[model samples]
Target: GAGVSQSPRYKVAKRGQDVALRCDPISGHVSLFWYQQALGQGPEFLTYFQNEAQLDKSGLPSDRFFAERPEGSVSTLKIQRTQQEDSAVYLCAVQRGFGYTFGSGTRLTVV
Candidate 1:
């Protein structure tokens, strides 16, 4: 992947449905992770991955939220048992020096 790409830019899930958001980072990136952004608020850290290893996931809000970066090129964020509070944009980013390159994000709406 040449740049960060997120799939199904918009997602609508039912109250109990599960959803998986995908992110493909640049070919050689080896640091950092996911963020959840609510309207009128800053992005909140969800997890971090160094290559294929998940070094830190303390930011994940609950057991129902899971993330993985298999093989280190792409990543997936899975949300189980969707709730109204889970409605937000899930962003995938890679560490680039002191800054980050973020994907367009997947907007999840629970109805």
Candidate 2:
């Protein structure tokens, strides 16, 4: 299988717009993770899944954010009522071998 892949490379959302960010992991990987990184800040864990079972979702900042990996292959991060401060890079990673493979990330901007 290839490395982790994320889509929409870039996104522009007007304030209050809803968005879904997607991530496709390498086949056979058993663990997946998502994070949100604000400018000049390190990535903040958003969610984690192990074989379709959502193991952790402690870092989601508000009720407006949600994530799921129903079949353990593809995952989606949905943000409702997007706000200006919601702009950042949304990242996904999959555990592979001894480490993790990460996606290029989705740069989100809200105006």
Candidate 3:
């Protein structure tokens, strides 16, 4: 991928349903990050992975949220038993030093 790409750009889920969002990071990027952005708020780091290793996942709000970068390139974020509070944009970024490229995001709406 030339830059980070996220699929569906938008999603709507019923409460208690599960949803999965996808991200394709820049080719060969070693660092990938997932963030959650609520409306009018800055992105908060949800997890980070270096290559295929998940170095940190402390920011995930709950056990219902999970992320992985199996091949160290593309990643997926899955939310189980979605709640109304889960309605927000899920952002993906690939780190290149202090610079990171961000995807437009998948807006998940749990109604």
Candidate 4:
């Protein structure tokens, strides 16, 4: 894709269900990041991947949240045992020259 792409723009998950969000970044962009954004709040950093290596995951809220970019061009943010607090907009972004290009995001609603 020409820009960052995220799948399942909206999702409704049952409590304890697992969900996997996908992100396809622009070609040639190496730095990728995942963020969780709650309503009316700023995006909170979740994880960062430089190419195929995950360099920073300290921002991840818990062990239930995991992110990977195995092939470097695409990434996934997976949530195991979804809970009410896990509901948020999952945003995928790629670093550009001095900024970032973000996907529209996946809105997850855990019930």
Instruction: Estimate TM-scores for all models.
Output: 0.94, 0.94, 0.95, 0.96
Of 3 and 4, the candidate ranking higher by lDDT = 4
Q: How well is each residue in 45-70 modelled by candidate 1, as lDDT tens digits?
A: 98999999999999999999999888
lDDT-wise, the better of 1 and 3 is 3
lDDT of each: 0.90, 0.92, 0.92, 0.93
lDDT of 2 by residue, 1-111 (tens): 258889889999999999999999756789999999999999989999998999999999999999998988999999999999899999998996789888999999999
Checking candidate 2 for backbone clashes, the offending pairs are none
Q: What tens-digit string does per-residue lDDT give for candidate 4 at 8-31?
A: 899999999999999998676889
Give per-residue CA lDDT, model 3, range 57-109, as digits (tens).
Answer: 99999999999889888999999999999999999999887888899999999
Ranking by lDDT: 4, 3, 2, 1
| Decoy 2 TM-score against native | 0.94
lDDT value, candidate 3, whole model: 0.92
The TM-score leader among the candidates is 4
